[model samples]
Target: MNNNVYDCAIIGGGVGGLTLAIQLAGAGRTVILFEKEQYPFHKVCGEYVSMESYDFLERVGMPLSAMDIPIINEVKISSVNGNSFTRKLDLGGFGISRYTLDSTLADIAKNKGVTLLQETKVTGILFEKNLFLISAAQDIYQAKIAIGAYGKRSVVDKIINQRRVKHVSSEKNYVAIKYHVKVELPPNRIELHNFDNGYCGISKVDGGNYCLCYLTKSKNLRDNNNDIKKMEQNVLMKNPFLKKYFTEAVFLYEQPLTISQITFNKRSAVEDHILMLGDSAGSIVPLCGNGMSMAMHASLKAFQLIEQYLDENISRQNLEVLYHNKWNSLFSKRIKTNEYIQYLFGRKLLTNTVIAILKRVPFVTDILINNTHGSKF
Candidate 1:
């Protein structure tokens, strides 16, 4: 509210930003958080979190066990030709909607004394003279440090002059679609069904509903004349598993949530004296279905680094270098490997062959899936 300089200022109220805010506030630090949207809203996401983050979320004040949501431990995957395989997940996961999760975290932070600014967007962040000058709706505030947790894309990236991820002419962009439905899928299983140029994942979230989300190249929609239903029939229904759900499921939303230009390119951990967290830093290809856990994990690392920075225990350069190194150590190889995996899925011959191989040697499939996910944190 006032122009008093804060110890830390966070942009975006997603999991990463909210986790950092909760940690800082709980530590008795003066923190201010800015969010462009109100709580209890939906976003285009897979809506499943890896088991790695289950304990940490409980520590952050979410009553996961008490929520009585789905605990998913089995995986079922199908290829475009309808060939499918099922396996037991190495580490199980749970599902919850962002609408409920984000709002709950916001409440926890507010109770912890975090100065949360709702429906307020951070327009630009400028670092000058060892301080961050933040601009939001004609108001400029100051903070010792700024965290960029803004999801997927934001004008703040351009203001910081960060390089955009380069996509080739043929495969330059992708689109994501999400919807909650009343499907007859099992509560303990997560499914990934492949179709032409895309894949769909289904899992149960709270309220006894299922999250049916998919990612596909932009060209698929364009080829279908920008009609989602047409694209589904022509491209996705090729997989019998997906066809069944699309036709038989009870759609809960009038219109599906969609986001375009989703890119999984390399980005810096720290930029312009600001630490980038979550999707703002780098995104894991969604086919693996663990992006939520990665974002929450990165937030924990960011909070630790910020504490060292504010306490003067580490030099500014050291803080930047440590966070950068830590991020790469934990996620660099995983992102690169998933990028290749995404490319592999886009090819028909390769995907079918891979599925055949996975069916023959089920242990190999477990190894591949484990590579994309992290251990319990």
Candidate 2:
């Protein structure tokens, strides 16, 4: 037995990775977390968290309720042609930036005694003789279990599971852009404005700023000579609502943050014998507005299974199988449903028609929207 081996090693420092680290360390387990970037960094995220995770976060040392966060209870969605309608959200969410949330979670995890390694990019992982070796930068760490909490895309995906990392140009990839700005939007409302082959979500986060983020097909950027400003001016601004917001809002950044080569393809729950969490396990469409909550919920599930495995109540194989089954049962259906919805709204005509139908049958809005979210976990 290696004297320096940790009970668990986590890659990436996003919601799932951080929360899982906090839980594991809080339970008196030796845990090590690797983060490629430093804390308080911006990410290309929608920045809206569903209410399902509010209590769970408060339970895990995040004082979200005490913070003056924006409570979003209403939603406004507009079509490509700017035809729109507002509806009440049955299980509404709140808004907070990844910059704030991740950093806060990191602080909590540290206070709970988790060894967090920042600015350390993991190079590889190898499972040998039931022990895992994690190679990050120039250091190698040993652990009984490893977790892939890295989000969206990573080279580790290829290093550990070559089959899962497909060429970006070969797949139906998407690009997401995010910015924080001063905008005059209702504090209790979130808006989804649609354009050709894409949608943008805007909501007020803490610190008196709004998170303006959008996702679109990769081809949209290529078609515009790979210029984000050109794509925004020609394609996104075509929507009257988008145009008004773009023109009226005070842009806070010289350049927006971006992430590319994003795919919603089904990812395995356990990759190369390491538990996968958050977007690393599976990704839902951004328009669903539940990815943040889902990631946090997954950490809760992973923590439970990992605890049993560490306590020797469950064998490693059984632990893997149970986590896989639980992950599928909790999120597979919702991911597929959101995929279908994304496909329908990706087209201009269908998006307009769907908005019209929802307006006419306003009651169905609650059902359809609520289907994308799960109850309090």
Candidate 3:
């Protein structure tokens, strides 16, 4: 192993890690990023970023127009019974596929002088005397500080045996399926269609395609013989709107991508010398449509706190306190609100009632949209 050390080591090359690498490299820090996957890979994501991330993207010198993705200014919510409501979102969001999004940021990081080790996974991190020894498969890297953007369900999370609060209920364990489909969905609109056991979203993406994604209770799929196509045909087809799309939409990709058994209860933000960001930190409910934007925003927070600690201006305890406080202030309430929304959607009666009420109260819809998506950064 070489005895060289970097100023910062980022463990995941997703949106959060790549964004921080670009930011820190621009600030003249010697940083290294380890990603287990190659560029232009698809992540099981909603593929929508809120307006709140516009300023951050601009700061990173990523031109919005250059993305070639569709812009959505309105949102439509529908129920299993075909009842629907439309609302004009106060702030717009963008749709770019993860393949393009990740590659673009990776290119920006490369151009900004951040060392990126693609197809490399960080096995473990050893903390000692204000430095970290990060272990990959056959290589080791030393760094003064580490950021764990390694994402959800990483082996590192298990290795740390991270503490889990008691409130992590079984109801939160779910699965997500996504597909790139060529359809006639409006470029400036996004649809959230709710079925019996869960909901699915559809919107236009960068490559003139539509991202059709859904998060459903795993038990529902299991009860249907573990067949995705059968589950869609029998359960999802019950919803007329989704039935129409599933029957009519031409899938652009060969098959739908799926991530199973996602747990969204909660986890520690900082543990064992690693700071989590994005989904690594905590994931918001998908219906809010702010997951990617939240990930990007969290990168800025993680960068600030890590940079301060690395500069030796703040004690580790104080740094953790500040980071936790900032994270809670920015996202805790929003997450809780989304969780409540998810619960409401789980019940068909409540979902329809809430949509009917919100349709009548335009101001309430505005507030809901604002809370779901914060003001632009």
Kindly give the stretch of ten consecutive residues in candidate 2 with the minimal lDDT sum.
Answer: 162-171
| Candidate 2 C-alpha lDDT tens digits along 237-338 | 999999998989999999999988888878889978999999998899899899888889999999999999999999999999999999999998899878
Clashing pairs in 2: none
TM-score of every prediction relative to native: 0.97, 0.98, 0.95
Each model's C-alpha lDDT?
A: 0.89, 0.91, 0.84
Model 1 TM-score relative to the real fold: 0.97
Model 2, global lDDT: 0.91
Q: Write the per-residue lDDT of candidate 3 for residues 1-377, one digit (tens) a residue.
A: 64879989999998889998998999899999999999979988888889789878978978776667788999988877778888887788989888988898999999999999999988878888888888997988999878888877686675664543334345667889999998877899999998877999999988788999999888779889989999999888888889999999998777789998687766667778577788888888888989778778888887887778878889888887887788778888899888778887846777778777777887887776688776665
Q: Which ranges in model 3 have alpha carbons more than 4 Å from their true place?
A: 161-170
Which regions of candidate 2 fall more than 4 Å away from where they truly are?
A: 1-3, 168-171
RMSD of 1: 1.4
Candidate 2 or 3, higher TM-score?
Answer: 2
Per-residue error at 342 for model 3, in Å?
0.7
Per-residue lDDT, model 2, residue 352, is: 91
lDDT of 1: 0.89
